[model samples]
Target: MSGQATVLVVDDEIRSLESLKRVLSEEFEVICAKDAGEARRVLESEIVHAILCDQRMQHETGVDFLKHVREVWPDPVRMIISGYSDSEDIIAGINEAGIYQYIAKPWHPDKLLDSVRGAVQLFRLQKETETAGIDMKLTPERVKRVVTEKRGAAQQLFDFDRIVHAPDSPLRDVIELGRRAADFDISVLITGESGTGKELLARAIHYGSSRSAKAFVVENCGALPDELLESELFGCKKGAFTGAYQDRIGLFEVADGGTIFLDEIGETSPAFQVKLLRVLQESEIRPLGAQRVRKVDVRVVAATNRDLEAEVRAGRFRRDLYYRLAAFPLHMPALRERPMDIPLIARRVLDEVSKAYGRAVHGIAPDALSRMQCYDWPGNVRELQNEIQRMVVLADNGQLEDRDLSPRIRSSGAPITLRNGHGNGHHNGHGNGHSVGATLKTQIEALERLMITEALDRHGGNISRVAGELGLSRVGLRNKLGRYDLRKGVSRDG
Candidate 1:
């Protein structure tokens, strides 16, 4: 927790190494070495925030040694110092070591100090990010779905019909899960916050499944009154009710040989739920004033923002209907969780809005993206799409910045912690104090951990790629990761 940083300098020449120690000792805990072997021994003693090493060492190269550090350490940034004019090998080493930046021979004290300082700061931030990951109860897959979706269908939000997304996005997963439900002719309950695209997902599933060729219909259970809802879902014969002019086909009959989406299913009254249960139980819709029951092959997909389980436990929704309708369940991740996909979402939403407005805008700027990423999109992707639409029309140019975002979603405050429980900040245990710096440090460590683990996972634990993506020296990334005791399978986002 000390502001003081410890830096290790490795070089073959004793005089030059001493010179660096003298220059750096004023602001840091300087550990000097004449070779990589001695440097290794010192590294074993205590955590070194940054490493300043010469390109050429006795019998070993600095780049090669730093590569070792990248694998073993994952935080401390690596900087290579060289007197030689030829930087070809040094350049190659830069990519390999994940070296932060290079210091040419005859370096300035200010430059050297600045470089080392930046590296240390980056190290602290990255380490803080890594350490913060332990409290994230959300798994990697969930995290990816929450913050890092890649559905091609979703990328084009121009029209609901042509939603393209990569398989990785939750949109596709939801569709796939719903499609599977369609094939079995079982009921499906889709639950998520408002504007979470539950109905859209249902449509996608219905159209993609085995019942694609059949009629697919939708009815909002909450939009109509109890009597209207009942009549809408089940047909009525002529003179069945005061308003009945002739025999009417309800959604079930209309959706015969296909699927019916019951949006806001939880909004239905208990009596209505009982009526639904009967339909499920008997597979027949009893039209009012009809002599006989009519059988239907309509598949049902129900959606609601409310927790039907708790509702059933309460006196509200019926337990029988809840059990029957929830033959398959799928929960959509909120947008606050998946900030990584903001850029993609924003770009796509802008394009759709542009087409609608009959204007073409290229893209969003970095500043706008900064705000987008920082905001805790409580309403999820739906909210983001709306904001982008407002910005597209409101802003004069394509360079939408902080002001372009809706006032509520405007990024002015600190990043909101959607993560429930534990200390929102300050990993000094939990719920003690919300020390901004401490919590920020903790958050950075969590990010560091996630990035390191992801890089490692993608690279099959190869130190090179992990370091490269993390902007750490191979040695630094490995070092930080080792300090945290993360090895084997990673626990990033998870």
Candidate 2:
């Protein structure tokens, strides 16, 4: 203790106390205590630099004992070790007892030693700061300003503007709704096809909210079994099940003051839905093999590609859970549904993939882009990204051309051609068609007009329905109707 930092290890179990001591004895002066009472006596006599206390004991909880220690001996860095990962207790220990770190049970000796060493270093830094009068130089206003600046940076990173889409994208309405919902403390359910960026929207909502300073955790609920999912979201005590050797903090607890994005939420079974519903309704979770329930303040943003309403009607999903999760629902349109956005998305992907692969490809040819827009991307944005990555890897020139596209995309539609005004070639091998001398812009306008006319006729001249089907706003569709001179037969009724 004369030269090395002194650490105090407290546990009721004799073997655990000895194990912790043995791990630290080589690097520091280690002291052991059987319980809180003995620990208080040691603290009163020894110059302890750090204290590692077991959370559970025969008489009192580690949190309660540490809270008392904080009042009496406030200098030493405090840490809690336990076989149970109860988030509520951990949070309480951190807030009330000023805990520095949490060591899970069955922790590796190297990790344990590292944690203790870090704690010792922190203790020394604090002592040096006090000795140099550095703590006195910091004011509350300075601290508040630093915190505010950090939060502002996070908000900017996850702002709604960060979401990639064209001006006329169908995602505009959904993004507007999400921006509004972010200011409120309510659950949101985002519905979309896979790879439509549901998790990205969820993140924007979280960081744009008041809870931006806190954690934002994500979990794909469809990837795990019922038991494992439960343990992941609600935590578990050591020995709760096979291989649960250490207490682990759950995502909900980790995101206590922030948001949790549960992707593919519709894949959860009815049994798991019941448990999740209970947690949502009560704002609490009970760790597996634990008798106590912990309260959490977490905002949930769930996403799924499935039609949950149909699932409920078919008795595959719970109606209550559906309603709970859909407090504010949003839908992300598929890539094919918003064809006008293809060029922008494709260019963005091209730039990203080119840089990642160290390629010189900086642009997509107009012909290749037109073909991509014609093909319906059933796999959505993710599929488009993969296609771009593949093309970048195989590209032979500075630009991505039609031949660089995958066979499926290249053959998806006819190549857009610019014929000479003198009709050097026929359009589509037909003799001297109207499009023979058409410019690229003229051909694009003709295609747009044809699509709008077909959509209007298909929806029985209902302007609103046609607009929605064409992924356009009502005003935009009206403008298109007027441009194509097809408004004469269109009805204003939605």
Candidate 3:
């Protein structure tokens, strides 16, 4: 790459280096280095956004040179152009060099062009993230914020685990455990409530594992019908079913050598469960009505909000399969259990949401935050995330205030249970009759209405989002808003 990027190609082969120069010259200022020593001189002279290095070199292995580059001058996205795809030494280079992409040689020009473009995109995003500050650490509150801004604004696909991975706090241990869990080729079962981040953990395991190089696919088991779910999970031969117009590779085959995440895995029916069990046990699957079984080396990582032990006891799940899937079980802590992490999590989530939405949400105000810590998150992190995303999207101003929080949280002045010295939990706060002289439910309801009204006003009366956390439909939410007669004069967008 020359001028703007000044790319450096390091290879002992003249033809390889020359061909690259020709392809890259029109787009970048091309610089050539025949060996490691020459590459060093080129690196010292220019700032490169991308590097295309050969796998073999006389003075040093391409991986060793890249490893050195990583320490001394870590610029540009690193790639290995190698013919030896099966070499252990080449694999060693992959990890050591921090290679962004690997191009198996005799390379095609189109693929090379695409790889460079992808590398450039990575470089630009890294630069912007550095300048814009995208630190990946999820305190409970931050995850709550992200739940609100799901997939967030700019349509940016971020490494969700990275959000929890970058922090230096006690949560780092949790993040590391998640990373290690991803490394296994066996089944992984993540258990957590609605918002506790089971899917987030699943994504982390996929990205931090060897499967990071392959497609990390996800499907909610409960989201579709039995036949649809089956079709989605396993590929079908043409005319296998009525809708099977063409032969399609199932997620198991599509995600070969990678991980296929089955979210809400417990939701699958008994018949569907049988198919899943066979896949796990045999590492092979026979498509519907097909006589032959196909072997798949895919990793299975499943998550559920429900307890499989209960499902097994109830005859809803297979006991043998339960044992197989829970080879490694990861329990994601609820947001309430990790209250100390809320402030940080909320800030990180808001930062990401603001950046994604192109808004200027500085952070959650401290006083508003203090009130947020008291309420129990029955729906867990997912609830918090949804609320935060709703508020961020609905927020009338840059600062997220107490009034901007969900009504359930803002109206949490009612009595709540606290642990006693005897280790029994009892109602501590007043006004709810769970305690003496408890507050009226009517009063709590009023506060709830007020909180919802304010969030709706801030969001320009967006019913879909206001109803999101409440688990109400848009039409139902609209009725509530109408009852409150929530209205606005000045536009939040302006």
Candidate 4:
């Protein structure tokens, strides 16, 4: 063996246990357990590659115990040893439990060693597949596209640099605070509305930290069910569940030496919150179906759009976990909150989109830029990116103008004319009441809602036609519909 793979031997007979250990220790690291109970405890603390169990132990049969192992710790290859029983029962039990091999008593030491080596090789292959899938799933889309090269010491803070903003950007203070927080190894909780760049800020903190040289992994807590979320964060044994064909590595283990960004932390269930609390309290994780807990050194940076404090007060989020995650809380300001940054953000996005689309969109016309600045961006930076990409693709004369701006943006807060020249369609943003003396933000939102509502009604809720008639991408239009709660009436099938 190139490396010493740990073997766990379970036998009630002390003499037999000593002999097995003596023989196996030469080529592998051997740990002895007198019975099933002791074997489980050993497994909880150490990573064992294979197990050799005497079929006729005192309290429990080896087959019975191995069956249990298949449920909670199935990663280790199992072998049953007993010159005592060649019974049909024993053979059936071994087959059902998925034992790697059946060893007879008075076994040859050389053959036993060879079987264990093969088992170890099988274990290695299973782990490789598990970690490979985990690595692929955990790579964030932004990281795949934007963070292409590794950053040197000088470039460690470059994530923050990619956060293009104007001189008078409201996020400047938040960025400063995040940079300061990155110096320490404390947990950080970033709060904001959707598309407000919470994950972007989390990345900045990771790269700005001392662990910048290590891996930075991301997991969307809300994207998976609670059961799966747990299994993904803490590894699982082979056969731990349906579809678990191989031993798996979790994100926590993958990010052992670095940072794990848990996005949508507020959306996780209370049960999962308790599990996460344990990881933060103790720097260790017990993989599902595995007997032991493994120590991990990881910095956590969690992000959520919800008001966590309110969630805690309302009993939706665990208070203890909330405090643990918010040790250093940072807030990402929405696009509407810092409308001055729109031009700067828009231009940067335009440049990127132009290059990507192979277009000649050099800049935004003053009228188009003015309209963007005046309109309230419900989807924040992400929406701006979509708008800019659309402009770049449609920029026939090299510059985006008012014509390139979507109907919703250009006419927000402007008077709407019905067929009979009546001004009606405006409501209190939520479609309930009139907006007489509403703030600019509220008035713009009201107008946007009215436009979408009228479009949906006109097209009989046909999203494709509505998006085209309004000069908005389908995705952009869908996001608006969701933001303004207009989807309840719209029908995609229509």
Candidate 5:
């Protein structure tokens, strides 16, 4: 048998404690504690590497004891277990006790053993960091290395420079805002369509932030059930609920000294929103079944496709949480609104997809690019990426031709005139399905409407600024607005 580290297991029930001891005894030295008091006594004497404490006890809760442990004897990797999935207790343990993992009741022996072994490894790494003169319990460099290694080449490519955009692209302003926000430790909310690279911007913000060297964990609130999502974000203890067989480390804990990107924050239920509000307000988390909350220094960067202000007014979202998340807000413009960026982004995607698929694709044809720029990209950047990859995979010649693009893009509308070196490719001059060319007047009005809408979205519905940018008098702009039926398009508050 290997000379393994000592593990302290605390539980009020003798049967369960004995079962845990039996499962772990062969691998390591097992110390048993019947209650928090007993656990305290064991901890005082033993040089244990990890502690597995029960959340529910007669005298002291697991989180309460662990919080005390964090103060006096903080070296051991702390974990909690409980029968109930109480979110308040769970959040408390995360914020106060600094639990390593929260395991639910009726844990599988193998998984529990694996968790203890992992905790031992964490304890060793932490000790090494301390011995190497690092003051923090968790080494930022070490954590960064692990995250980078796990994420591989993809994460490395998400830095600020990778956010490709043309010089006049509206995304440039958003990117600049994000970079500036990264310098400060503040909550940032990125609002955009699903495929508009909100997560990409979030990653860039994280990597550019002061906390870049620590973990940058991500959680999708919309992807999981409320109970599961709560447990995932805050963590759950053993016996916290059925199927919670092992202690789990939450994204909040993993990103304690770094950032936690919460995607689709608007999709979370109102009840879950309240819990999230508590965390943002207190800057702490309580693991499921925990007795006290644990403090965390994690910066939050939330992203959503929904209009949270609308949600808040509809009573579907909590106002306080919305305000907390949007302390700094960044919006990504849609792909259709930034047509000039399409060619550049498409070329970038082509290069990436070519390498990924081992294709010998050179670049995109001008005609194809012109076609792409004409189509209104409802799916935004994500759709474009998929289209580019599809073209790369099917390209017969060195370059992707017009025929290589999807039928949706090819059959959409008349190709826009390319500003760069691309030649003027004329469509049948039909508007939307009309084989007849659009009258010169119809064409001008369409172009005018497009420009006005872009300005409104960019300037947050500032009519005066829109008029100035379009080189029109306020009355002229107002006349155009009336002609185009655009008066209701922007709110007066902007």
Candidate 6:
């Protein structure tokens, strides 16, 4: 009856029951039951939105109890929590009990909370559709209209306009391309360095597409081993392997009508690439233990920082898989490549961090902003966000000053001052106004030469260190050094 969704936590162990309750009590009306009988009684008396049950119980297994619940009152979303070793029983229970999700042992509080939230959303969506007389018989147009109505808020939140960039920012072209890509149902490969907001762009594409109403799932492929990664994306049944206890739905299945963003796809092994290539090529996937393949209508949006084309040439990656994923490739410009956008991004990040931490910081000082734009952010947008957050925390006054910036960023680049006059500005502590009548290309070359020389001196002429600092390959750096005629004093050591 309360506004908050009610969740039933059923665990034979009192400690676990209490822990589950504690984790969810802040957001939901959490009710605890020691066993199946107590859970049944509570479910009959209260309106439960979701059920979190422990698989192993003293009297009856959680599966049996949930199966009974499905027969009697099946509206609540059901999830089972068990150790990795309970795969066989859990797999059988999945279909028989209509289990929505399986929580592995030692669940993270945040992840558990996210799962519960998703279940509650599903519950509410189901109820809404039923009440609106929207069923399987509805036409595609009708379904799209209703779903779009329900998901309008999310669409607005992730609209293409939400991506912050200056008018002349290099990212503008990429965003436009991404927006155009969103209109079609095609696989997208977003290539960029880490923290360059590849996932953010992926979200924008998904929300902008016709599949906005469905689930937009994400998985970091590099975080898990080949076996686990395969299981996570392609699903796995009980008895698939050692410790396989429950039937798990893959991210592909979950994002059936929407998009699945696979981050760090380049880190997958060649063997795994073959499997992924099959899924993309055929639009179907076979679970680890299942005999039949299931067709999926999910759009795949994969991202990586690695040069996958180079990897293919080096025989470290499959050329076939690379082609499949890069059907609509979009490259994200690194932070240094889009220096004009830094001031805007920094201001936005400052506001977000200040509000998140309840700080009184109002703005970044002009000098601090200039220094930020001058420094080459090797870590890209993610690094900029972290820097802003730190400055907001350490700031004493209303503004973030240059003193609050990290020492490396503060000392990395020469001071940059933009003037409204037609004459170009001076740099490198030089009084000669060589930039006054220099062409754009000449000015760019001058800046590059200065950066490379400074980096070489600061890094003690180490080629590798200077190359990394400037976001260039060793060979590319060497070529630049040769062009600038500065390789004479540089060390050859890698």
Global lDDT of each candidate: 0.67, 0.78, 0.66, 0.76, 0.76, 0.79
lDDT of 1 by residue, 360-439 (tens): 67666544564565566667777777787788778777556556777655523332232222224322344533323323
Which candidate leads in lDDT? Answer: 6
- Give the TM-score of each candidate: 0.52, 0.62, 0.52, 0.60, 0.62, 0.60
Model 1, TM vs. native: 0.52
- Model 5 misplaced regions, further than 4 Å: 1-156, 416-494
Query: What clash count goes with each model?
Result: 42, 0, 29, 4, 30, 6
For candidate 2, lDDT tens digit of each residue in 1-494?
11356688999999999899999998877889999999987765445668999999999999999999988778678999999999999999989998989899988999999999888766644433342244543333454454456557767877899787766678888999999999999999999999888988998999989888765778899999998898889877656788776454467765667788999999999999999999999888777865556667889999999999999999999999999999999999988777666666787788888888888887766556656766677899999999999889878878777788888775555544443212232345555433433345545654665566557667889987887777899898876665444565597575
lDDT for each residue of candidate 5 in 1-494, tens digit (9 for 90 to 100): 11256688998889989998999997877889898888876654445668999999888899999999888777778989888899998999989999888888879888988888888767645543432245644443574454446444544678878998866678999999988998999999999998999999998888887777666778889999887997788766555677776444456765667788999999999999989999988877776765445566789999999999999999999999999999999999998777767767887788888998999997766557656766778999999999988898889989999888888777776544322212333566633422123344333434555567667767887778888887989888876666444566566853
Error of 1 at 364 (Å): 1.1
lDDT of 1 at 137: 34
Top-down lDDT ranking:
6, 2, 5, 4, 1, 3
Between candidates 2 and 4, name the one with more favorable TM-score.
Answer: 2
Tens digit per residue, CA lDDT, model 6, 284-373: 877787665666788999999999999999999999888888999999999878776776788778888999999999876655765676
**Stretches of candidate 2 exceeding 4 Å from the true structure:** 1-154, 421-494
Residue-by-residue lDDT tens digits, candidate 4, 1-494? 02356789999999999999999988877889999999988766566778999989889989989999888777788889888766774676656777878888998999988888777655644443344343332222333232334335424545787786655567988998998999999999999999999888888888888887656778999999987888889877666777666566677866766789999999999888999999989888887887767677889999999999999999999999999999999999988787657766887788888888888778665446655766678998999899888777777898897788777776563332233213354332533333333356644544565566677878899989888877899899887765544565578584
lDDT tens digits, residue span 253-363, model 3 = 546566788888898888888888888877776655444455667788888889899999999998987898899887776666655455556666787788888887876
Pairs of colliding residues, candidate 4: 44-291, 44-292, 72-289, 73-289
Worst 10 residues of 5 by lDDT: 416-425
* lDDT, residue 192, candidate 2: 96
Q: Cα RMSD (Å) per model? A: 34.3, 15.1, 19.2, 14.3, 15.9, 17.9
